[model samples]
Target: MDTPLISASALLGASPAPLLLDCSFDLADAAAGEQAYVLGHLPGALYVHLDRDLSGAKTGMNGRHPLRTRDEYAAWMASVGIGPDREVVVYDRQAGMFAVRAWWVLRWMGHTRVALLDGGVDAWVRAGGSLATDVPVPKPVAITPAPAPAMPTLDAAAVLARLPGLRLLDARAPERYRGDVEPIDRVAGHIPGARNRFFKDNLQADGTFKPAAQLRAEYAPLVDGAAKGSVVVSCGSGVTACHDVLAMEVAGLGTATLYPGSWSEWSADPERPVEKSPAA
Candidate 1:
């Protein structure tokens, strides 16, 4: 249970079943996830929307998915029936891209008993688990926000102050990192010193995460010698970045800080330096 992931088979047989959260999402179609959930999902599982539920309202500079205040987040969790005592399981069909965001947020809320469903809903279906269309009513529970010793994060200014000494890992694709393409963010380049580590690199061809030892090895070059705390993971607006953070934890590399504003916030500011490879 030290790891942040739980297999579908293991979840299927657990006594006193844990709360299941289906975080399926499609970046291209925001409503597609809920539509999919209505069609079929794990029995008793509740749907958590990436934009509607997990993220805060976006201002011009706060990035697309701004961080919710701890108090506000605690209330949301409570409303969703998530309490300290609940052993929560989060999953999605998109290779954990969206599920990891929920997992990270829960951890940041100081709920250590939560974990991502390994390989997502597809894994469950492959394991002979059936999907249901019925949605269950969740009993709300009051939650007291505990101090999060595990999840650490940095704001834009803090990241700027840290500079070259801080190891910033951009979880976007290489093309985006190189300024060749930027389908979402206005800017096309990356933060001045950030290294690209595309979140998809953490997954296998089948969409499950790679083995721990292999992950540890693959992440070595990006992390370099920086201590886990000095390493900051980021993506478009901090969602996919959590995938990298989870990968690091799964590799036994300890918890890394998250740059929640990520590229969207950084690029919004003309004052910040943006880097890109030579024209290609």
Candidate 2:
């Protein structure tokens, strides 16, 4: 069986057809991603905004991009022409960062036919796949959404509960993890015991993810002897963390619980311990 990645060439010839979603987004510029999508995308790709569609309505300390309710997410999926058990191929700007959010959401909702466009839109264009400026019109679908709240998640308290036994992976840049630079979050540094593994490290020089064996090796140290539920994945606002989850799943490590609030919510509280210097 192939990995959860669908390459540009494979996408070009996908049988039974695959629903392509453009999940391009600039965290710095909220509107830029949508603007890029409106300019041009795959022939039949639909845009999935990180803020508007993929995430929930932010009320307070719930983090920047919280997961939406099952009903809301399913409705959005339907509007994008997603049917139950349909094949989906999500893409972003040549990197799997943002697109995997859609992939993770689908899997959380019990849709197993979801995959990502390896190397993303740039890979498609580079591979001679045509782009379309015209937006696609997909017929709205009506399907009962499957809710799996048990989809391996860690709440702010859950993280604290398992603090001693947990192996938390922080998917932020090294600088952010070291407290050398704080880009988007309120505070610098990371959860006291969490290890740093930049999500981009999962990709090759060409931006496609590393092969399964390599990824398995990369994760083996952290996952050894750990109960699957004890591994928590997190990042700034819980976005890029999915990239690591996707990579791990590709690596056959199975799925880890997502700390959706992540550092964003964790840091907001003064009680949680924050560590600045890197581990010895």
Candidate 3:
């Protein structure tokens, strides 16, 4: 896969500069996240709210952070000056977690030109890029997002039907995956047939992603004999799971379908089986 990662240095002084987005958010304190962005962010960067700009109204089984309608998202993009030809670069302070959400969301809306700022906003500062408290205003540009009945998504029933070969990967922490401690969702365990692969494993110690080859090697065994499209990526509320999907794309493993109705939705259904492991 062609890399969708942009290096901080490469982005510096880029001609026809990309649309910079700050996507940092605290799951617990939504207001604080936006405040953090207002305090200091990349010059000319616009702030994207995780709960507002990136998500849609939640219907009964739509899961938390359900994706907004394609048309609605397109309008939002236009209002923010995003168009098909724009080079959009999204970043966050939290090791690409929230940023990748933006990346996946854009792709889901049929814009493949969006890229993630490698290692996120922190990397920018480390590369000597300065933060600006001022936000830039740009003229709105209209775009027509391609039509799709829905994003490539897997429901809980579909996941259960996939059975033993499905390769359902859970992006939660080991403790949460093993049912030791679930900080967010109501349930402490994971989907019955899911395997634990913390989203952070895709990155290096410096908060940057591991090289493509390394990522490929890391994921090969876990996905052994499974069709690339057969693998389903998921997490508590379908957020960090995008991180795994992004890593797979970077590794050239091909795209994995997302289970937007992740553990949060899965656990809500009493009929769905939950699994806990002594070893996560």
Candidate 4:
């Protein structure tokens, strides 16, 4: 199935083939998921929280948020009644922050038939779509865990070994990238040989993604003359980095692999070098 933004009207009626997911989450507020869902959500949408559903136990020194295992994610999907053939549509409160993470996870697990809701729930409401306060409890569907693809990922050793060939794309704000300000992690700065590309840059003023042609033009110079697959994306803790990956996909560029550890893991080890300037 081709990736296309689905409308709230299309999802209101019975859509057995389509799975509508409301991936609304706020990192600061843990109760944001149910609060947002309770206020009013797209009709017949299932809620998926980033911290509760998408992540696993935070083992110290590993990362701030580690991804759940494949089996875990598959079980959660099955419990939420997502089947392999279902055309999934994910949306979040803001543009596509949390929704894009779900999109990337599906892609990593080898599911290609998924799309983000353009402009998200706000757009749906503006388009005269219906909303419901009550959450729908769906019957569990059996799902087989698909094998995750062995895309190019890098550890500190691998990054050090191929520093020249691999272009690390840091999907953090310019301030955080430059060690000017860090509100989350303990240490500031970025991985060595990494370039900053704030994830928000991929979106328009209205929170929707820019056109494919515009996105292509913006990213072409960055990956120009590089090998078929040379870009690796990382963020504070691997969540927002998927935004960059999705943008690259929309731009018609080859899929960029994610560094799930990101800065959270990279900074844990003082032995690994961190750079404050672009030259670093």
Best candidate according to TM-score: 1
Lowest summed lDDT window (length 10), candidate 4: 5-14
Candidate 1's C-alpha lDDT? 0.89
State the lDDT of candidate 1 residue by residue for 1-280, as single tens digits. Answer: 4669998899889788999999999989999999999999998999999998899988889898888877778888998898778999999989899999999999998888998988998889998999998888978997777565458999999988888677889999889988999999899999888888999999998888999999999999988788756688999999999999999989988898999999999999999888997644
lDDT winner: 1
lDDT of each: 0.89, 0.86, 0.86, 0.79
| Candidate 2 to truth, TM | 0.95
**Cα lDDT tens digits for candidate 2, 152-180:** 78789888887765788999998999899
Candidate 2 ranges beyond 4 A from true positions: none
lDDT of 3 by residue, 145-194 (tens): 65673347887788888765678899998999999998877778988778
User: All candidates' TM-scores?
Assistant: 0.96, 0.95, 0.95, 0.92
Q: Cα RMSD for candidate 3?
A: 1.7
Q: Each model's RMSD to truth, in Å?
A: 1.4, 1.7, 1.7, 2.4
TM-score of 1: 0.96
* Residue 209 miss distance in model 4 (angstroms): 0.4
lDDT of 3 at 117: 90
How do the residues 129-194 of candidate 4 rate in per-residue lDDT, one tens digit apiece? 778888889768898666756345566567767766678889988999999988988789998878
